[model samples]
Target: MAGRAKRLRIHGRVQGVFYRAWTVETARGLGLAGWVRNRADGTVELVARGEAEAIERLIALCREGPPAARVERIVVEAAPDEPAPEPFEKRPTA
Candidate 1:
């Protein structure tokens, strides 16, 4: 099945809390392809490609991140057609 791609910007208590790793695991479980990383401003940014339903589920999960996270808000937008490498990865902080 064809899937949509999206760029997600998660705000609030997302960094330094294993959020990226958690995201990787979650997205992989949903069979998503993309990457996640911490931004300079302490937010988490992720690019995901997968079934719409799975992408939505990943977004919802970001709203309630890892055990130590205190998610405040999430901004989601469509990713460009240029696809990233397959499978999910935790990238270095930007």
Candidate 2:
């Protein structure tokens, strides 16, 4: 399968709203590999790598986050191409 990766910075009500957990579940469901974590600036950051279709689905889900999250904007940048072979995770605060 074709593979792609992206780094996403999600703004607005993305922190303290189960965003990380939601992202973990979403990524796992889509068979993506990466990690999601909360930024110090109250945003949520995630690096997802997987099939093109799965990546697109993950991005679409980020557009409308968990029930408590009110995502304002999502900025996605394509990664420099790499192989990812792991399950999704919610990394500790950094």
Candidate 3:
């Protein structure tokens, strides 16, 4: 499978809106591996690794998160150094 990895920072109405859980579910459904956490700065951060197309689909889903989430923006960056080998998880607040 074609693989790709990325670190994403989601902004605006992300925290306290089930964004992390939503992300975990979404990523897992896409068969991606990574983790999602809430940032102290009121953003949601995620690291995802999987098939290039699947990862892109997951990223797109992040752009329009859960029903309660008003995802304003999502900053996606390449993370070629770190890789994950499990299903998505919801990490503790940071």
Candidate 4:
């Protein structure tokens, strides 16, 4: 399987809107590996590893977030220095 990884900083009204839960579900469903957490800066950060196409799909999904979330911007960067977590999970805010 072709592998890819990315670190994302999602902005806008993403907190307290089931964003982490939604992200966990979405990433798990796609068989991706990563973790999502709320950052102290009020942004959501996601580190995901999976097929190249799946990672792209995850980025698109994050752009829309959950029904209650009004995602404004998503900054995605190649996470080449470190690998993502083993499994998709919701993590404590950082």
Best by lDDT: 1
Score residue 80 of candidate 3 by CA lDDT. 66
Q: Whose lDDT is higher: candidate 1's or candidate 4's?
A: 1
Model 3 Cα displacement at 6 (Å)? 0.5
Clashes of 4: 0
TM-score of predicted model 4?
A: 0.92
Top-scoring candidate (TM-score): 1
Off by over 4 Å in 3: none
lDDT of 3: 0.87
Q: Candidate 4, which segments miss by more than 4 Å at Cα?
A: none
Candidate 2, pairs of clashing residues: none
List, residue by residue over 39-75, the lDDT tens digit for candidate 1. Answer: 9998999999888999999999999999999999999
TM-score: model 2 vs. ground truth: 0.91
**Model 4: per-residue Cα lDDT at residue 2:** 35
lDDT of 4 by residue, 3-72 (tens): 7789999999999999999999999999999899999999999889889888999999899999999998
lDDT (Cα, tens digit) per residue for candidate 2, span 1-94? 2478999999999888999999998899999998898888888988898888899999999999899999999999987666554788888777
Number of backbone-clashing residue pairs for each candidate, in the order shown = 0, 0, 0, 0
User: What local lDDT score does residue 61 receive in model 1, on the 0 to 100 scale?
Assistant: 90
Which ranking of candidates, highest lDDT first? 1, 4, 2, 3
Q: Deviation in angstroms for 19 in model 3?
A: 0.6
